[model samples]
Target chain A: MKLWEQNIRKVKPYVPGLQPKEDNIIKLNTNENPYPPAPGVERVMEQMKLDKLRLYPDYDSTELVNELAKEKRVDPEQIFIGVGSDDVLGMAFLTYFNSDKPVLFPDITYSFYDVWCELYKIPYERPMLDENFRIVKQDYYKENGGVVIANPNAPTSICESTEFIRDILEHNQDVVVIVDEAYVDFGGASSIDLLKEYDNLLVVQTFSKSRSLAGLRIGYAIGNKELIEALNIVKFSYNSYTMNTASIVLGAEAVRDKEYFQNTVNQIIEQREKTIQELDELGFTCLDSKANFVFATHKSVPAGKIYEELQKKKIYVRYFNKPRINNFLRITIGTEEEMNQLIIALGEIL
Target chain B: MKLWEQNIRKVKPYVPGLQPKEDNIIKLNTNENPYPPAPGVERVMEQMKLDKLRLYPDYDSTELVNELAKEKRVDPEQIFIGVGSDDVLGMAFLTYFNSDKPVLFPDITYSFYDVWCELYKIPYERPMLDENFRIVKQDYYKENGGVVIANPNAPTSICESTEFIRDILEHNQDVVVIVDEAYVDFGGASSIDLLKEYDNLLVVQTFSKSRSLAGLRIGYAIGNKELIEALNIVKFSYNSYTMNTASIVLGAEAVRDKEYFQNTVNQIIEQREKTIQELDELGFTCLDSKANFVFATHKSVPAGKIYEELQKKKIYVRYFNKPRINNFLRITIGTEEEMNQLIIALGEIL
Candidate 1:
């Protein structure tokens, strides 16, 4: 037996969306921003002093949290930053989901939630989404150790309203509720507005989608100071300097340029609407998406066949081979021209 | 009572070296490289396309691992990258040190070892070092689930020979033996040389000390393919994209420029020699240090007092308040002028 095999947890790792090996491909599989980061990002990259890199970064990510607090209109103590939203959410799971009662989440949301639960040995139950790919608010009224819901749920691309989330929070007052808004910038109403009313609410957002800084690995959580402290304690024990200097500096600049962020978000929303209309015309069933991607299935073609055909045409979209959603394709909105190419290629494939 | 307070692991998080808020201070607290990164690092930063920030980085650190394998004379399959060495070692503890038998480490080794054990809920025993502060190889003859030793052990600054490490490995064939070479570039013999003879040995090194990339957050482990696969399994399950793109791109550049890495290492070794001689003249008991820093105690002065006096002079050195090391201080070697200033300040304090 291998020495490492003794205690290693056997985990089926979450397979991220296909990142194309070849360039010049109309990539729409991962829900990444189709536009470049804010113009200030380039400026931050240029102005960063390579000399200061000899020392460690600020252990608390003080400046980034301060800037985010300013933009989000919260106390600096309410923010917890990590390498990415996955890191933030993973740490949150370890910190708050330790009760003997089973934690809860949507069965078909971002797949990483279940993986984290397994990694930490947290008992969790997946509540099924309705046939319309929407969360049933009534199902979450039962007792749970904790809860997490991806606003504008992944792959399905349907978001629950802030009031619906608040209703769930109202019932689950004793347990922490995590609202992952990874793709909320497109059109979904954020639960950050509910943070004031619900102390148990933890709202997580990322620069990966709306701010276009996925390569920089910046993500954060906004919650009550007590919850944020719990995260910081775990983070400090795990790794003191989680964020690199380049990311902290550049992420701050990305957030500071609100106009550029808004413009890019607007462009993606416009393209998503156009793509939804085009998909409907092509005789496909498309969900009313509030994210950077559209969830659709052709009336006649199998989703796998469409995915394979799109690969041959150098266009990529996400397709899960799991039950209930195996027939659907989650197509990330790309540039208008790129989406146009995708549409033309799909027309031929069909 | 707060909902999360009950489950929160009441961990006294490891306190990292002070990162002073003000500039222009002589920072010798953390054993960070005094020099800047390779010239190629700047070029890599400048040439990185801002548009690529929209997409996620390669989850596996493909290019970075490829370049590192070439430099380290190992196969790409033998390498595993992390956010930093702390992140690397923490994951290793979670991966391999889970047998019912307790893991073993040096009593006066890197302080994070115990913290990691606590974080992972691993049972560990710290066998005491000899009075000379050298690891007694015979002490490790007993059975253990795993073993980790920081060569040129932190706060002691003493290195064990590769033959000595091999003796321990020879007995512990059923378990993994980890040799952390974080400061090995300063002068010590790297256990990387023993990888050919021992498949059970996992050697970890960092760019933070010798390559001047602490703020970049890059570290890696070299082991047999099976052990590496175990680490990758946990990493992929934990966080797919740990290293940000800039660290991956520039860390490769830092490794490729071997001549620059050698030049900086030599300069630090020279400064270390000069500082050790000077401290000896000041009636200090300095260890036979082979690392970037020296562990010393004044014959009559308290280590805490010296640390405070150095801080008042705007200089910093690490001091632990624990037993056995309470009287000693770990002083990182700085530029010649900075070392001279530190010596002058010590002379006045004595």
Candidate 2:
């Protein structure tokens, strides 16, 4: 080892999905929105004062927070915005999970959970999901430092009901429960309303998938004022100006246009349902997905072979090599035309 | 304390300068550039493709990194970009400074250094600056896990020569030494050249000061390939897509216009020298500033009073109430007209 590397903390970094430079490929590995952001976003960007780049952005992210609060029907004090949902979730991990006991999360959830636990030296336990890839709430009843549930979990694309989440929260009233709702806007119910009942609950959502601003990187969390305050403390300590001016301004513009947001979300949901039925007809055992993606495994084909074959045709879908889910493929739902192409490609492959 | 607050790590957050929403104020508290970003930046903003935001930004910031590599005359492998210099420095602290020995920095330097140490649970020692507010190189010769020297250090507005930095690096060859050149573009010489001699040297810089893109939040570090890789490991593990799409494109455009950058930098340096002479004429003992700011203490007046008086008149400057430097005010260099108005205000106050 190099002399400087002897004592530093080191961990294997997470590999994000391929962001192909070429434009002709069907990109579905990462669950990014397939539509453009709200029309107001473009207008705001056009009218933005380039001169303002000389000054620092608002440290509080006042405009974005205000817009989110107004949209979610919560007071502005209950909201916290960051560069992306990953940033918000990372800050949450740093702030709330500090006890000696291990935090509890689902084994088959967003892979970042374990990576974060390791980074912060926070002990954690991953309770196994049921055979159907659903969260088992009773497993969280045991002691834990905190709880993180990625609602409509990644890779599985299965969402748990809020009532089930309520049960988990009730059983563990002392620990902070972070319900990451990155995919909730597609079809799953949001846990935002439960914030009124549980002071320990934090619901994290992102504009990347639903608002179509993945490249802009705006994510937020809604919770009780105290929870938000704790997050603010951590954020300020880490990087005070986490959100830049364009993101704060354009994100607020995107949030204010409710009709555009809802219209795009409905379109995505319709496309996702159609894609699932088509995959099912091709002899794929697909999960009951409430997210913007479908998780399916073919009845007679190895997922690795199918993934390689699809890649040759410039069609990309996420295929994890981990245990218990190696045979499944997670495909992001695109526009109707894109989905039609994806179906045709799958038909040829099968 | 609330139930969720038990045994969690907490630190007093760093307080940044005020970012007032009103447009009429002559904002000078934060050390921001007075001129706008390069004209190319405005063009990039105008021609921005709003459609691409639906996809994620390049995880590696490929284009920005390539641009920076060409501009800095360094290999792309030797660069690590971040949201701001704060993010770059924060990641450096997490990646290096892991041994049992305390990290070392100047006591009266940038306040965020101490906050980052506390946040990462790294032990650190602050060596007192000499009476002239210059770094004492001998003080850093003793054992340390790592060292951070802010060239043309903030609040003090004084710089240490690269020869002095070399002496410190010679004594401590095993640990990482970060030479933060945030204000190097104004008048101070950069330690970037020393990277050829020392494998452990890391030079950090930002676009916020000389480039006039504080609102865009772009910062970078240039080091040996190994150190850059170490920072990348930590950054990717923390947040893969830290740089948003706009920052990547606009920051690169800002870097590409060499003539514009040099012109603005020269203007700032000229204004800084004039501002120092004026402050000296006004019975203030101003430090020999090599930065875009002037640090001065009035011979007969208190800095706190001057700060408050300037605030009353809609002119803002930074005043820290810390020990040994309580009388000093760090005034950011503004345009010639703005500086003249500031001089008039100071004359009346004194």
Candidate 2 regions exceeding 4 Å error are: none
Going through the candidates in order, their DockQ values are 0.75, 0.81
| Best of the candidates, DockQ | 2
Candidate 1, A109-157: lDDT as tens digits: 9999999988888899999998888898888989888989999888888
What does candidate 2's lDDT look like per residue over B206-243, in tens digits? Answer: 99999999999999999999999989988888888999
Q: DockQ for model 1? A: 0.75
Q: How does residue B264 of candidate 2 score in lDDT? A: 94
Off by over 4 Å in 1: none
| C-alpha RMSD values across all candidates | 1.1, 0.9
Residue A268 alpha-carbon offset, candidate 2, angstroms: 0.9
lDDT of 1 at B205: 94
TM-score of 1: 0.99
